[model samples]
Target chain A: MNEVLTLKNVTKSFHQKTAVDDISFTIGKGEVVAILGPNGAGKTTTISMILGLFKPSAGEVRIFNHLPQEKQVREKIGTMLQEVSVMPGLKVQEILELIRSYYPHPLPMSELISLTGLTGEELKTRAEKLSGGQKRRLSFALALAGNPELIIFDEPTVGMDISSRSRFWQTVDSFAAQGKTIIFSTHYLQEADDVADRILLFKDGTIVADGTPAQIKSQIAKPSVSFIVDPETSLEKLYLHTEIDDIYRKNNRVYVQSSNTDRVLELIFQEKLAVRDIQIERGKLEEVYEELTRGTKEAV
Target chain B: MKIFQMQCKMEIVRVLRNRYFVFWSLVMPILFYYIFTNVVNTNPQDEAAWQAHYLMSMTVFSVMGSSMMTLGIRMVQERLQGWSTFMRITPLSDSVYFAAQMVGQSVIHLFSITIIFIAGALINNIALTAIEWVMSGLWILLGSLPFLAIGTLIGLMKKVETAAGVSNVLYMVLAVSGGLWMPLEIMPKVMQNVAQWLPSYHYGNGVWEIVRGGAPEWKNILLLVTYLVLFMVLSKYIRRKQEVA
Candidate 1:
């Protein structure tokens, strides 16, 4: 991988509770990697170490092939923290202009404003008076203002409106299309599934699952086949017709789970029963994530 | 250097916007140079006595304004607002941060003191030797350290409100102790002794001596320099600890 950032054997602790314990990961250039974890699962700690906000106990972080504290390294990275937005006292133009002076080649104010989903009149308004979703959009705008090669957004969407959340994912996808590296963390699983080129599900102080969503889905052991049938069809007759492992019904929709999908399909063909909309897998990442991380990964 | 200059300009712009500090910048020197000095001249019609009184009072005001309160309280305010941390993420060095603050504060204080000195001399109809006049104006800057050091110490040790409260109380103590607000000779014998023990008194004493065109006095001048070193080291130490916490 053409990596922009590398972490090796990283461990960080506050007193005795190991915040990050022997965790290692790398983010390649132009890769949109979603860091998925519950709250206090060492996601923020890892990000802080990468940003040089705090030092790690056991390992090191290499940003642009240099330590994060180095000015040369920091200059290449744009940080829009969870606390990115400033006070209402600052007009949008004034804040952008001030932040722009920090970098060598920043995105033009017009471009950044557009990228963040803000327009002419809203850009003139004070930041503090903006709605929560508006503030989040502006936060991302400021992060992109520097035109940095790498952006790290922690918990990018925690309290966003559904429409705004959808927009946020679209922005992430757009950033990826621009070929910039992003290390974004969120408990919002569906967002991860949508945009992440790769996903690392954090558990305790380490990653429990590391791969593309398909690879993780394949890692899930129980891929069951299900069937729905008419209520008039006898349960015993249905059981006799197919090798169904389990059967259940809700609103006259017959549901079945079978270990042998091929035999189940063959039995369905043989029975000539009505089958409506067979969902091959659960579309929810939350279910898969919980099953992967629970009891299997060490917590701290 | 460019970064320092940028930070300096930004800080100055922000500070100039504050109503209270802006009000003080214009008001304090005139209060000291004209009113307080004129009030002290028991023989106001005597041009020589008026010259002595005006020069001494204004020197006291200028040194205190430029060094102690401006650097200390203002820095504390900036730290409280998290502006200092905002500035810290930049490529600017710690030394640059401190140096720019010193230079900027002195620059603003320069205007207030300069106006007061020129107006005081002209109004009193008194003349000073060309070197003495120039030196007295320069003394406001030269004597900036001890009080600035004091201000920095306050900034390092305090958060917003605590720093403000501490600075006001300490400025009062220093003003009294240094004989800036009153004559040390008029202070109680105990206060006179305690006054001699403080760097503020030494700071004020150094400038007061030069403006009077007296022979160069080395002891108080040396003591003020000592205070400067002590304060810089102490404040640096405190700020370093604050970063860790």
Candidate 2:
């Protein structure tokens, strides 16, 4: 596979404070990579460097083997930043048309509108008057106007409602299906887990972990089984099993963390314990993200 | 070229749709023209001259207001909201973006000059040949370039509210001191000396020279051009500072 983006020891600093530490990664074409981190983890700073909005303090970033600031390279990239910054007092169609005119070849207005799910009335409405969700949709449309090969979204669904968030991801999925290289930075761990083929967990301006969701999950080496039981049914015999790593009770549910879930199930069945609402889940990416990034907070 | 044209069109449409911008750039200036020439100055002997002078003054006033407040405030707001940064990342070049803004301000300037000229003819019976009218209009439009640069510089340096306040104060001071509202001869000697150093004075004097059927003096042209270059450089420096920040 062709590498679409390459970052080599890229570092960005403001005065004496570093925003993006010396970190490097490569993204192949047609791959969706998510940069997941909490606020101030340098997610936005990294994205800005990729978009050529900021000059890195050290190292390099290359898109299509060219510097990100090159016009030829920028022409093939689209971005939707965290802030919705579309021109005010203009109708949606006008803004779309204006942005489309910037590219050598652009997606047709109809295709862009339909792909972003902009309703006809929304197209006619002034950008400033649109609701928050509608404004986000418009931002998405602008990002896709150039029919970019690489689309970078910085917290694209930050303030969107649940329905709008789902719809936004649906639109993104369709674009990804067309073989577009996608890179987005988001704090929404579930979004990264569900959509990204590879996730880069960032903390303290550095990548704490980088792998597929399953690979990251496997690092913990434990699956969790949880079920609600009668508050009075817990017996001391459950603690005798060495297969379980840890056990905890929250409200009416008992949770078992174990590499061997089958043995735990056997113990529960043999014990004749009344259980309801049973749920078994492998180690989740969220837990792995928390485990990896939690300790590095004070080191920097 | 197409991108430039599209940006211009979008800006024009935005200005037209904004009632507040339209009122300040168009309606208010025309009203001032009527009040100053028709109501304040009714001398029969110098009625035509007063009409022509005030027409040029109000035209300059409107141009300064539109270019500084309309274009400058918009640029500042865009910078604050991250729209300018967004545009910078796109394929659009900085020169093209600035060119588009210049063209938008020029369109507004042209409209203001034409309306004031028409008001001069009908309300004050100010007579001018086609050449004189066209030449004077071009001079006023050209003279407003420094203010456009000033506006862009202020936009880059300050927040939207601060930009608005500074531009308003600058506009009024320039108008009153430059003799756009009242002649410098009526003012004190020290004020007239101060006005000589003001770029607006040179710009207004250049326009008045054109209206009186004389070519603009080279010194006045040099002054306006110097101020334009200074503001342009200042804006560029501020932009670099912002990028670093």
Candidate number achieving the greatest TM-score relative to the actual structure: 2
Which digits, one per residue and each the tens of the lDDT, describe model 1 over residues A3-96? 8999999999887888888988888899999889877788888888888878888899998899888878766777666654453345677667
Question: For model 2, what is the C-alpha lDDT against the true structure?
Answer: 0.86
Query: Which is the leading candidate under DockQ?
Result: 2
* Lowest lDDT block of 10, candidate 2 chain A: A291-300
Q: In model 2, state the lDDT of residue A64.
A: 99
- Model 1: share of true interface contacts reproduced: 0.04
Model 2 clash count equals: 0
Off by over 4 Å in 1: A85-99, A116-142, A157-173, A221-283, A290-300, B28-89, B92-95, B115-130, B240-245
Quote the B-chain TM-score, candidate 2: 0.93
TM-scores, one per candidate: 0.78, 0.90
lDDT of 2 by residue, B1-245 (tens): 77888899887888878787778777887888888776775464676776777788778877877877788889888888888888987899988998887897788678777877786688778888788889888888988888888888778745778888888898889889988777787899999999999988898888788777788899899999999999999888888886666
CA deviation > 4 Å runs, candidate 2: A224-258, A261-281, A295-300, B41-45
Error of 2 at A209 (Å): 2.0
